[model samples]
Target: MTTRTSPATSGFGIEFLGLPGSGKSTLAGHFIASARQSGLALDTVRAAGRRAMRQRLRRSHARFRTLLTFAAGAAFLRSVYPVSKYEIGAYNRFCILHPELAHAALQAMSLHAADPARQDKAGKLWFKHCLRFQLIREEQGDANHVVAPEGFLQKALSLFGYGAEPTLGLETYLKLAPLPAALAVLRLDPTEAARRLTARPRQTPYPLSSMPPDQQFSTLARWAELQERVAADAASRGVTVIDVPSHRESSEGARILLEQIPEDALCSQGRDKRP
Candidate 1:
């Protein structure tokens, strides 16, 4: 089928979103290879991983000072409740600057320490705050036509860790990043997703590894549901959203994802747009 083409603007960007073990990296690899082979004028840019973010913070005096403050708060949290350095760092990187989210993080930790039953609710609220901040950072970048595999959508899925509902965070992220040229959501069965996650080996014992299979299934399902809702909303706004099945071959999924992107989006018009 011939795909409709939109004018290749300098602002074209696409985000590949999915839960862990949902084939995001595999599909992104296939998509990037195909795009390059087809001579598409697009660059595959991986999301700034946590390590990079930490390195950036370590270098900045202003940010480092803020990190120190967060570290102190985290120390207190550790005294009261078990907390992961990774999560505390995420909160510091994303939520420290924002008052609302900072407060939410404290509240979430407090609840997690005092009321185990309400921990999930508090955590989800904190996740929503962090997700909003992360999405804003994504938009703050100067890159155009970015092939982001693990973008803000990952944060949306992560909200499930804090609570059962992921929609509020997902919705807020959309408001920040709005409609991209393409938003390809990788879909998979919750049970299948859990199986995949279980089989995978981790470098370290993280929270995800410790999560129960039932919780994993529920979280993945919620994430997929939110993706569908976001896709529908994007459609109303004229943004293209391609739903790729996790069961499909990565190559085939890449083709479908590419097809949804306008041909003009692949053309480097005049200037050198290399990043």
Candidate 2:
């Protein structure tokens, strides 16, 4: 008699969900760097802004092609460029200023005027872009891990609007992806997170013609509310949310996270198979 064996499950994966200046990006950088240094093969998925001209050039054949193309290009550029860096910085500098408006602006850009099909295509493109980058690390024979910031989901939702509840697709992706055995939620106090952001070396120019102060304040309030909602939703799921106090040293935090990885999952002789 022949017996059937179940297929091996895919390795564990993780997603960091949080607002901008919430330390998701910074912690992701730290986590990835530590994993690599510890001889673990890791992959990273970064959500970056694509060049405006390239997007416009691709849609050149559409109806009202010339005018629509320019308008779209201008909007895309505005969403990311001179305005983006400044608007983001200003909002961060004074949380009270136009937070809701800023959040709305971000949401608008995320949901650009693309048909459903085109939007789906964009998501695939983003996934492919991340995969391509992962392949680069693969060539180096490093451990494989994928890291993307919280903004990734927010932006995707803004663009795609996955129905009333939202985040359904994000939840599905997490469940389906072959991630790590342990899911770690790197957390820092809000004050500390803000302080680290302020201390960052690079600074962008703030746009003067931005939304009014009251509008900005409303946006900030909304942003806080959104963060609470995301955290609550994520916790309701089975994700292992880890809070690493900012006062604690980075090395200590990294060590705590490293310890969370299952012992069996560690690459023995740097050749462990996927879980």
Model 2 local distance difference test score: 0.41
RMSD vs true structure, all candidates: 9.0, 14.0
Model 1 steric clash pairs: none
* lDDT accuracy of residue 48 in candidate 2: 20
TM-score per candidate, in order? 0.58, 0.44
> Candidate 2 residues 1-89, lDDT tens each?
11112121233244554433455555666766787787765444432223222333344435545656666866876876754442233
C-alpha lDDT of residue 274 in model 2: 31
- By summed lDDT, the worst window of 10 consecutive residues in model 1 runs over 1-10
Candidate with maximal lDDT = 1
